[model samples]
Target: MAKISVLSPFLVLFMVLMSSAPVTGQDGSRRQMVPAMFIFGDSLIDNGNNNNIPSFAKANYLPYGIDFNGGPTGRFSNGYTMVDEIAGLLGLPLIPAYNEASVNQVFHGANYASAAAGILDATGRNFVGRIPFNQQIRNFENTLNQIKGNLGAENAATVISRCMFFVGMGSNDYLNNYLMPNYATRFQYNGPQYADLLTQTYSQQLTRLYNLGARKFVIAGLGQMGCIPSILAQSASGGCSKEVNLLVKPFNENVKNMVNNLNANLPGARFIFFDSSRMFQDILQNGRSYGFSVVNRGCCGIGRNRGQITCLPYQMPCPDRNQYVFWDAFHPTAAVNVLMGRIAFSGNPDFVYPVNIKQLAEL
Candidate 1:
């Protein structure tokens, strides 16, 4: 694996070439890198699917999208998610939430991310009204049917095969389910054992997506969740929790191995694993060089580390939002999101293996 820096000359060249591409569409690009981009994940990538749900996980109010063009759109960040940035890099418009997307919009893509959602159905039961990954996939099938109705079965299959699928689930499974006291998961299995359990379920879900005409996949591993403001607030020393970080290591390892297995066994399918943990580690370790001042607390929210709760409606966030690594207790600010997105777009194999999103699109 090539551990390339963000300033790698090759990455600089790649960006130059991409920016120089011809313009034709309403967007600046001549053509989209892919036919469509389907997103599946939790609040980290959720655009607005949780708005109407009867859940406490919703984020449709102010200070949330203060930096966004359309204002708060249920995105947990001040502006865009990593996927939103990736979508723009792909030369496509931002994908709409599954609930809000029109049939016409489905041709481009739809986001099925729900806040507090997870890979397991029961993972976020405490949230009351989140759509789990399985339900999200069912919703995708509905969208696929619409695609087939409009484009015909054969054409739809061909187009769908070329579409990109961005999946970034499992954070909620750790944060909301397995770690919660109300849930019996911790007692049932130890850390590594629990990770194995989650991975088994995750493997099956990816296979299901593959069976549903998905060919190009970008499976994002869990980030450095233990270092999140929420976990930092929980720590007695007010430092990142090693115990919490260790728990997700096996999960990421298993997913990387799973990506390899899937690519080898699945015919015509190509999958890439995004090493989100490593990427975040780089940011945390070099926050100063990255131009960040606050790496331990959220720009919004109150209490210890400003992480006891997510940001509230109409809450006044910090003035220097870009200097803060966290937007809230659990989410990264747009600054971090965009950095991670672009890195995944063209980072070396150490970050996204065996090829980055741009290379995968070309294939």
Candidate 2:
């Protein structure tokens, strides 16, 4: 997807139409669009999976879920994540985390996201105990077994075959591994080469998912990691890092290319790449138009740019979270999540490649 300094007139109109459209089931009974939706990735999509784990990324505390119903259910944001909105857009209930999955909910889907996780197993080693992409896949496998036991083998296979697999990986590979001074990845591979390594690993990981019964894939591309609050705080001028942004370009491009390849290689499988990078670029450029007043800093946190680890426990967030682009140091606010979810659910090709999530679900 190309970068746009300003949203087009048609896009604005289209967005209005989409937002106004009533979301209902095929029978107008409010049934879910997909049988299930299994989410995978890092903190961006993580709801409560990291809470029990012995990792430093837990968020089931006050000020974290200030906007959420339960008031911080381990989500990194103050309210819903993008996937939460997407779940509603798909007419499905909020998907539960692997740890929170019950027998009945196993038929719906499960979220396996953990903070600091990445495509590479070692990407978030410093975080310790984070569930990497591969481990998340294994978690899904366990859920699949439970599904098979509950729904029977044949019924489970059919149900799983039609389910949506929303994978948003690779962000932490840059933030937690390659960019971290403690890691030796940067010394081993240059930008493009590292991207190739990650993509190759990503391709196989996704293929494993296909073999395990994922057919409808929403592959979320990496966003502008360099523009996050943490990166900004590290810069002398408090600006976005040019080198960090340049490093992940190949990874994003490679993911798009990999999507095309996967579509051709895998039979009965459909894959669409969500251009998260372009979404961030659009938000950065047209934030005011989107009703965002603060974009460069976190709504709540303590430090140079509130880019420290997550916000301090019990810390008071901004009075109005809807006006900020970022909720914490590394995640978007609930409002931004809602916006991205809506657009990706039914936006044009500029944000979602080939076809959007709606079209993919219809397939």
Candidate 3:
């Protein structure tokens, strides 16, 4: 996924008003002013930070970027993810990966999305080589310091205030840490107990972001992990894993409530929840609607059909890539990701906010 900082439409209008007065352009070249953007999240919005990390989830391999730059760029897709699409709509450059130090100064935003990262700092401890959520924030602060030195505090404030904050994580926390290992033994709590804990932690982290000048929030909820190709294959013939799905329900519901509560608390805070479960359902309901033949079949690998591993070297790439909704077991294809981005920014009520990403950007 491409990392990005989304801008709400209202902010654009306000910026237009603020810049209505005459201002000289650099090099005598007139240009529409652009605000700086910042992004934070996991693999779904990651852009190669994990390439620097030793993780099994790394996308710096063959066939991953076959559609984009002719080679894998560490993004877990054949093309751009939601982050890239959102950034494109916002007219921002492709968000640079946090680990990619070379282009730090050129891009408007840096992606702190490490693969397998989560809401809480300790979601996936097994993936120690990867950057954690708290560390990502620390890196963000570091970047902001550099940006502040370059643009000054006042201009930096304008940049930070006007930029959209995209956070798409928390699913891994539920799937990898809490559920798979059995919360009762690992965390010594039932599913609901663990979910509440996760939600509280998520709310705190989000609050921290809000306090740090992030106002426009695009929060993506957990999808149907149980209905995913990986999970389906795991429970094949045995049927869908209702137990895990039940465990996640409260977390997703609480996430919605938490966003609402945050909106009520913060003055300019605009929280838009992307119910990924429904979006996935829509794809499964009518796969052809989004250009997919098998909603359950992945575009890569063999054992992945049995929920064994990821889209790795030994996997079989589908003949018609565009016809598949899933690129692998756990992630959506680049096409579906683009579609999701469109729904998010376009003010599509079915996907995000009360409308789409475009409308939410204006909010």
Candidate 4:
């Protein structure tokens, strides 16, 4: 005799709704993998923090967010930044910029990223006004207080511990500091010595977050700065600048070593270093494989390689934004941002070492 189990009417409806929900995994399990995604970085993931700042690094105008739902929301890309894609992939809502976030909004997460920001406070002084990494950390401390007031200390602490802290800085330190002809950073320290100094400061900045209850970190290494349209345009041959690329290599190496040391020394501290340089190099070396027709030129800038100057207001970008890797002289297009997001989320060990964001979130 065979026994048959029939579901109740309410049970049947529940099962149907659960099956139709968008939060289900491939194995049909329902989950919200992460509590939140607290982001801090430079223009690469700055949603709109730079808008209020009186800085030339602002990007809250047309052509910036042409591909985003709420157009021109101050993202440096054509649409969503890497964090936006990563948040969506995590089944979380888009994180709001720290300047614009309400007390209630802090539950989902907050973005402290700022255009022209760097790991060092003095890194982006040319911008006139920008939230440096130290200032951004202070902003997060304020957010933490708000969260504590909203959810009470214990619950807020739990949220903070569970949240993934993403950091993608240092590029501006090179572009706007070390590389700037007038800046004294170049004369003060050469490549390796500068890299060492940056790493030391960065290590302390990260420790600040760790002390504040951030247990999981996703640290993005500096990408190949030499291959950006701005650098490429500097050369008559329009070739990638080997010298500039060599300059950043030691920095990236030091960053990885710092991560390893942090993980070993800090109890319960877990880190996943995203090898952005390798990922960008891969795309530049094999644009065809990534559905990119233009890798060395900006889609909306002016002059040679479309990168002599940044994309101006009312500027007409390339017809096919997906075909271009860069949106402006220095930032990536939305398509490229999305690709990087996916790679950081679930790419191989080559891109995300030790573990990917997905694995870190699960942890």
Candidate 5:
């Protein structure tokens, strides 16, 4: 394999030229921003990596992707995911799950995300089986090796560095760890202390990606976890839990800081932090503005608030999925995902700070 130092110049020149040039597709109808997109994190972007796992976090059945053209390809949403929208905006095809990707398919990048996965390995023990952030990075390493084998080391380095990485994680850490009754993380550390621990670990994980030839990154922050239907169902009035929301603030703050530090510290590394909290809050505060009527309840699922239980196989979902913000208990519907993707792709500084996805891809 070619060494990092040997491939640095080619990677740098390639990125510079690609950034300045307008990427076009075969039909020449749209401009392709990035060569490919690589995804990480949890259920929010799992695609289908969890389908073969032993965990109950799978989502490859009916009512899950009814809105999607392929129909339930293991995406938690009804149609597309944030990654899908972002890939579409970049003029690239939908990336395949890492487990199902063939050698040829991997040239477009892979999705190693898994449901119930978190930044910490122990974060999703309740689900029994998951590819944690650490293991996901390892999977990416294997991907890098495969790319090197396919395209030769220099071309592989250039392709990998030029590709975009979208990471949406950390919610499970709060839901499955700090907030779980069986877990002692809450007692072991306060909100701020736990956030600090998560940030420290996250910094290392990102740095590992940087070392593995990833240069462009889109890191999404945690949304209003307390406002999700599942959490709201726990309340008597079905109101969002202020306590839970407050607990997540520290983690988001730390993540933003971590991004800033990475940009300043890592040469050639361009990162964008997507503010999911503000994005979700805007939709919840003004649902009608976004064409959403039910921001609190999920379109699918059972019981009060339609969140006591998740959307099971053969269960009928809402008539109009676009009218609902959330698809199931904890995941957003495809409508909201596409909205978030558009914002991340070209939204102003308000949603994506420092730089948006378009700017990052161009760089």
Candidate 6:
């Protein structure tokens, strides 16, 4: 089976959107006229933050960032991920990982995401070297304070206010934390309880951000975790686990409700939800549309569907990566990340929200 890269098609679509007509920013500025971008989430948006942590989730190694920097830069994908696309759209340089000590702080913003981070403070602790969601918030605050100290309070406020904040987390909370037997039993939380916890924690985080002058938010919801090659590989029949899908449904629904409630509570605040459910379903329904020969087989792995624990040179590597939707057991390919960024930063009104990320930055 020949692997076909899907980036050009999606890239063409995005270019068409940008070319057809221009969308004005909230401040009446043209698109790509933003000052900066602030990122917070997991490996999907992490650059090299986890590399310094000495964790299993770190991607600063061979075969990870080989396509871009010719070395692993702590990004889980072969090249830029969704966060980089968002930054590019905003006219800001790609946001550097906070752990990238070599990166100068003069740029737009920094990434505070850890690979296995989640909304809960203690989630993903046992899976990989995980940063708790609370810790991420603390880091953000510390970074903001540092910026304020250097740039002065008014300037810091203005820059932070204009900057767009991107969050790509929550999947690990459910998959790695809640689903784990010991934690689930320890917390005595079933599906609904877990959803409540997620909503509560998310609301708290959003409130904290709001207080910190984060009015415009781009919230990337959980994609089809059940449809990932990892869960599919677990099935002897090579099918997605119905149980996991069932669990994801309530979590997504509660998340939608939480977003709605938060919007109602805070006037003049705009929040958009990107439906990763439909995104993954679209890929599965028409694998050819994405140029994937085997949608269920990961791009990196050995025999069958085993890439989580063993994905290296000795194992098998697909000739073309963009064709596949997933790069490993738990993450999307670089091409898919680009597609997700287009959707996240500038999708149709219904899919995105009151406005896209480019417009939000203008606010």
**Alpha carbon lDDT of each predicted model:** 0.89, 0.86, 0.70, 0.86, 0.86, 0.71
Of 1 and 2, the candidate ranking higher by lDDT: 1
On residues 1-363, what C-alpha lDDT tens digit does candidate 1 reach at each position?
123355644345335634753222125643688999999999999999989989989889999999999899999999989998888888899899999999999999999999989988998888899999999999999999999999999999999999999999999999999899999989999888988888899889989999999999999999899999899999999989999999989999999998999999999999999999988877777676567878899999988999998898899999999999999999999988887887788788878999999999999
Task: Return the lDDT, model 5, position 164.
Answer: 97
Measured on C-alpha atoms, candidate 2 has an lDDT of: 0.86
**Winner by TM-score:** 2
Expressed as tens digits, the lDDT of each residue in 1-363 for candidate 4 is 112245433233334533543331122233567888899999999999989878998888888888888789889888879888788777778899999998777888999999888888888888889999999999999999888987899998887888899999899999989999879999999999999999999999999999999999999999889999899899888889999999999999999999999999999999989999988887777676457888889999998888889989878889899999989999999888877887787776767888999899989
- Stretches of model 3 off by over 4 angstroms after superposition: 1-34, 101-107, 182-187, 304-306, 314-316
**Candidate 6 C-alpha lDDT tens digits along 35-154:** 666788887777887776757777777677756645678888777788876666666666777766332453467788888888887777775577766787787887788778778988
What is the per-residue lDDT of model 5 for residues 290-334, given as tens digits with 9 covering 90 to 100? 567888899999877888999999899999998999898899998
Candidate No. with top lDDT: 1
Who is ahead in lDDT, 1 or 3? Answer: 1
TM-score of predicted structure 1: 0.93
Which whole-number lDDT from 0 to 100 does residue 326 have in model 3? 78
In candidate 2, position 328 carries an lDDT of: 81
TM-score per candidate, chains pooled: 0.93, 0.94, 0.85, 0.91, 0.92, 0.87
lDDT of 1: 0.89
Model 3 accuracy (lDDT, Cα): 0.70
Comparing candidate 1 with candidate 2, which one achieves the higher TM-score?
2
Error of 3 at 293 (Å): 0.9
